[model samples]
Target: MLWATVDVWPELEQAVLVEASASVRKIGQSLAVGAIAARADWVAGDATIDLDGLGPADLVSAAYVLDEIAPASLPKLVGGLWRLTADTLLVVEPGTPAGWQRILAVRSQLIEAGAHVSAPCPHEAPCPLVPPDWCHFSRRVARSRLHRLAKDADVPWEDEKFIYLAASRQPAPVRAARVIAPPKTGSGKAALKLCQPDGSAGERLLSKRDGEVFKSARRADWGDTLA
Candidate 1:
């Protein structure tokens, strides 16, 4: 069966777009605008409207217009858009894991009202679409749940920052390589290393060199160096 996913109330500001672009690329998904202001060329007449820019009174006006055009189709349309033509729905909120929890609550309410539903899967990686400082109680929730699901399903979880994966069905194996970052300068010079379960030595190198940043580094590089 096909699956539909929705990212509700996504911020369309410049910063949000950059992060979202990276996140969408990881999943191989195309970008589409949810709402538009002033009817631009990129916006479809039937496209969903984002009420964020409008004042309360303007929102009321927009609501009236929407109701007049497609009264009964509102909820279904919104839900369908998020699902992206999937027979199953997957609602996503990447910024705040806590927001995901709220979405989960809404999903529960919908299910209780007879909508088909599934348990919320936490996103393991950071959400590229969210601002750097965007923190939430749901962060760990997504990370832990997604990790367990990926391991149990035998799917390789990507280790990128701020991107989480969830599917209506389990995905195929995708190997994820970890990137161990070195400690900042003034943290002292040490060689970092990784010992495999099979007893193989990994990488050994100094933690940092000047302003350059390394993604993965050895832990042994941070301790006191013996000359």
Candidate 2:
């Protein structure tokens, strides 16, 4: 999940990774080595990180390690990490009920801690999808031969669904709306479900000849920002 972000954002090279066990550093190092940009100053360690000694980085990441920790320890952990973020910070967890709860809590805490929403979400406001609903995104992964055999899977591609958050210290981009579902286009009209900045959502229908709006709708996908 994070490797994808590192590939897309050129300025996101320097990274500060914190894990409680610190054993996950091996997996992180493998990804970084596989990356084309190896110039990154990789700083990987346990939870007791020295923010003052190392300073901030372009990216700060805490992966699946967070879900294992105590709920009461979250604020201190996330709050301290927020201050160590320079450009972006990402957190990834499962797509289950527990995962959604963590994401929701972290979302509010990030806003309160003054971090801006970067992706998979359009605004810093509360999430529109209330309980019984959750927001998650999938990254298509190509199945390796060994991977397929281990899982007894035949599909060549798989979508890894996970709840993630990307926040920055900068202001969020100005997006009028964000597409929350795959758009439907037919009969010279387009219909969309959008996530708005006010922490609510609505469906919109536009004619094919509606000019600018129709064009924008045609290009947007399930998780794209609608300008």
Candidate 3:
């Protein structure tokens, strides 16, 4: 049925290979939970373990139960059932250097366990998870051009969102990266800016004075700051 299993871990790279291997072997799936708190949609609901302090043992238990129960699907598991299959198991980590290391570690373990491994090739084959409606400057520009070309060609790519023209046929909205301002001491102010991929900007000010205009201008001037 083309089943895909995923193990989400906070610090996946530092996982103990032997322990992971044992858990995977015992679980009967190429994928096993790493240092994750819970399965994709399956919530343990067990308050015995501290959610803030998850570890390997917790991961193993979660994986074991998830693989054993094998819920209908990921969405179905949203109700707290863990589901998995043997077709494809994805051990995903956070998007950090340490996360990459954990992904590699799991990949190594899978290979050593005689499982086929595939790497994400952004250039050759971009991830399907990346939506075309994403609001990255490059992606937005590419979509704009494609929409123009499609219009000229009398194609059926017309959509208000403009994401229908994306080669991946996915929506890609550039989510603004959040920055936490340092705590104010006396009467200082904190501000946040929302900058779109295009040359548009918006801002929020948290001070007595009306600094919205200033913040917006600052955001536009420092468009490349977050990037």
Candidate 4:
């Protein structure tokens, strides 16, 4: 296993070393990259941490890091990352509209490079969503005492909106449509917003008369992949 970061932030560097210890302790191989290589001594005890010869990995992930990169450098950075991805590449960003646009751009670039969409999107066709609307999802996050104080929040939890893309070098297994929004239910009926396999996004209203399909709709949650 390997971990890389562009900067040498003390906390971040320490965190990476801590996380990589388990991999090093058990498997006996790990590589440190970029500026973190300068502090190579603090890595796992007795493990030989290589400071050179970086190579492609099976899975590559870039989370919330693109936002720190300059827009003009994005293409080059993404291309470099993709070249390093032996199988899959996962990218994540804040779920704001601007964040979604950045992901969308990356999505296009990956597709153009022959990668296949593996999640959140059922098809490779251009995102069905248009301006004034975009694809995103929310996750419930528990807040620490310090976090609560920082945000001045009354709730112990908050919804973190985020957008992500999982692209693979090979075609992905067939998947069902993804629920793009919270389902609306009332009086034995449900309306679900779906991004379907046919490369379309729309609402589908299901009622008791539809039996199992209706039941599925009622039970569906945002971000679910429904058949």
lDDT of all predictions, in order shown? Answer: 0.30, 0.74, 0.31, 0.76
Which should have the higher TM-score, number 1 or number 4?
4
Cα lDDT tens digits for candidate 4, 63-154: 77678667887887688778877888888999888889999999999999999999889999989999789889998989999999999999
| Candidate 3 lDDT tens digits, 3-122 | 211233343332222222344345533334442332332233332222323332222222222232223432233122111212334333333333333334443444444443222311
Model 1 misplaced regions, further than 4 Å:
1-86, 95-98, 119-227
- Model 3 Cα shift for residue 157 (angstroms): 24
Shift of residue 194 alpha carbon in model 4, Å: 0.6
The digit string of per-residue lDDT tens for model 1 on 2-44 reads 0111233233222111111345333432333333222112221
TM-score each candidate.
Answer: 0.23, 0.82, 0.22, 0.76
- Tell how far residue 185 is off in model 2, in angstroms: 2.8
Q: List all candidate RMSDs to the true structure.
A: 18.6, 2.9, 19.4, 8.9
- Model 2 ranges with Cα > 4 A deviation: 9-13, 19-23, 27-45, 48-53
